[model samples]
Target: MSIATPQNPALAAALILAATTFIAATTLMAKALGTDVLGTPLHPMQISHGRFLFAFMGISTGVLILRPQFIRPHWGYHIGRTSFGWAGVTLMFASVAYIPLADATAITFLNPVFGMLLAIPLLGERVGPWRWGAALIAMIGAMILLRPTPASFQPAALLALTAAAVMGMELIFIKKLAGREAPLQVLWFNNLLGLAIATCAVLPVWQMPTPAQWGALAALGLLMACAQACFINGMARADASFVAPFSYATLVFAALYDFLGFGAVPDAISVLGAVIILAGAAILAWREGRQRPHDRAPAPAAK
Candidate 1:
């Protein structure tokens, strides 16, 4: 039992870190494919559309093989949940192109803070003192990261913040929907929604990608799917908080990829901000681990 705590948490965090790092690296590759190979011709929307198109097909194919009947879900929750995911995907992809990966990822750490705030009203989940303190510290760290001045800030940072906010909303809806459907069903709706929204946003301006660009898009889709799968499996095996902070490892991977692959390195200020982001995530993880003792399945009643 004791072994499960550290062992499972470490395994889950490692899996999540790998998944997120791959996804972050793929984003860097997408930028190269778009700019260098595609001559900066592929719009963000177009890339999103292509990526989601492949993802939807991939998920649909798997569903057909593994669970044929899932082709049609309960339309109401499916549509609702899909909408949240749609917005999250669109916003997140847009941010990826506009912001530095480290900054973008740091802003994303705000999601759980927002989630904690929303839970008080939406889910009736308590915010407790320790979690609230952690959230405050996280927000201060976010301000340092954002800088929020013309000389210091890029407008793209705001986009990443908005992406985080939207992600918070998506997560809330996901939590609500989880009890009603299998996780795979939720994942299917997410991809379908991503495709639908990306199509609606990008179709008017869509230009077909060249073979190389298409290959990059395919790679991007595969990495995105892999990240989602590993994240889900990891969380199922351990606590979300325990697994969440390592998601920040994507920042390290992103920075390294950008430097080696694109010659872009984050500044010292950005590095400090990244540290704060990791600190906040660590605080959240510790809080959850401590709470675990108080959480357990109810004992079976005597006959």
Candidate 2:
């Protein structure tokens, strides 16, 4: 068993904040790429394809410079993880194009709720009353945000929820992969397999991007890579539960982007639901943090 020593809290918080900002920016840029900000809107698949394609290019270049061994025997696990990740990205980008960025991003926070449910079956974990109550509250919050009246039903909101669920599964796969693989190996496979899957999916619907759109696509990939790196750094330096809450800042940044970039704002109900979801998620995070043994295994190294 390995013991964890806390790193500098201020730096961890700053890294997480920066990561969320980058991610929020990437989401807004992706929405613009698939919307009318460009002369012609790209397909969501095409946008996702560019995200992974360029990210792979950048990371692979770094890998060559760093000269890390990339071989791994866990092809099956990599395939499963990247496939879910690609699906989540497609759904998320599609939701972003159609909904307010804040609402879409808030819905994605349901990932922890979904992850808890998945752990029951996949990890053979038992759910106690506290967690079950938290899950119920989160579900209520999701329903509030969804507001699924016949006339008010939004398919985009459902898409965001689906993306969150897929992401939850991706997290589970990541846990499995982390047990046996290096962080860099997992990162490499994620980009490599994600690129291959996205390219094949986008080929039939692909439209050549204009110069401006191309720049946006490149920025999208760069921001995503930077965000991942920042998040990894933050997670490495602090207890995950301590830094994870800062991830909710993505909603704030997304809201700002939505208002300034698109003149869109979330309604009152959406705001209330977002608060409820955050509250429930906070409870879960707190419980997880408290349960973490001081003498437990050390956190894995950042990629």
Candidate 3:
């Protein structure tokens, strides 16, 4: 059964909000644990590898009992997406180490911008006037957030950008695959593929995590898995376009955590950039909601 209804906007919004919160927190938790708890240099590979191993195992167990037939489909998309996901994961985690969570999260939001660019070329998706305008505004915001100077160029930020580009491609592939394969199968494949790749890459650099770090890593893994599952379930309960904007809630959550946990406040310029990104995301979501004409109105929440 296709899992989207235009009538249920509120449900979709809540779903997106919850999912975004979890995802936003993952970066803050990963960076704090990797740097402070692990007592090791923050390497994206280690975090990604560790998180995926635990998440994959956790989800796979459920599949084993509920539906074992997912194994075949899992291998194909999982391996393919893991190739892209690894790059995205590596850059995202690295950015957390190199920059504040809000900054990294803001830059990562550039994924939608990349997706728009890719859609025009690969998917033949039209870049309508409003979307083009939104994209331009988002670019301006990106420049402000980056604030490049001759003396200080952040290669880490660039890696994040590259990762977003790859992630955009992965999104396109996943959307196509979603129609043909079960959601669990798709997720399983991606995780397993990432696990194999990460295991190989992290083996050389892997330092045994201290007990505290182990706990943090475990928490990170659980949060990541739960966040993703919540997102999928919530998206199923409502329309994608309605829920997509709620993804921006991550920015607010990230900013809050940065201040409270790390005492890191975003500069005015970064905040401005974040606002611009949110505006652009809002435009995108509006476009999608309109495109899905039959979307159910969000079910009213209890007073």
lDDT (Cα) of model 1: 0.67
Q: Per-residue lDDT of 1-303 in model 2, one digit per residue for the tens?
A: 122435887899899899889889989988999798985999989999989987788777777888886554488878987898899888889899988898888888888778778877887666677777877887788888898899888878999999988888876676566536544556677898999999899989998899999999998987887777777657767776687788889889999998999999789988998988888777776666765442111121111
Model 3 alpha-carbon drift over 4 Å, by segment:
1-8, 68-76, 151-153, 292-303
lDDT of 1 by residue, 94-166 (tens): 6666567777777777777776676667766766778878777877778878887879877767767776766
lDDT of 2: 0.79
Full candidate order by TM-score, most accurate first: 2, 3, 1
> How many angstroms is residue 30 displaced in model 2 relative to the true structure, after the best TM-score fit?
1.4
Better of 2 and 3 by TM-score: 2
lDDT of 2 at 94: 88
C-alpha TM-scores of all predictions: 0.85, 0.90, 0.87
Q: Write down the worst ten-residue block by lDDT for model 1.
A: 294-303
Clashing residue pairs, backbone N/CA/C < 3 A, model 1: none
TM-score of model number 1:
0.85
In model 2, where is the ten-residue run with the lowest total lDDT?
A: 294-303
lDDT of candidate 3 at residue 44, scale 0 to 100: 71
Ranking by lDDT: 2, 3, 1
The alpha-carbon deviation from the true structure for residue 298 of candidate 2, after best TM-score superposition, in angstroms, is: 16
Off by over 4 Å in 1: 1-11, 33-37, 68-76, 292-303
Model 2 residue 246 lDDT score: 83
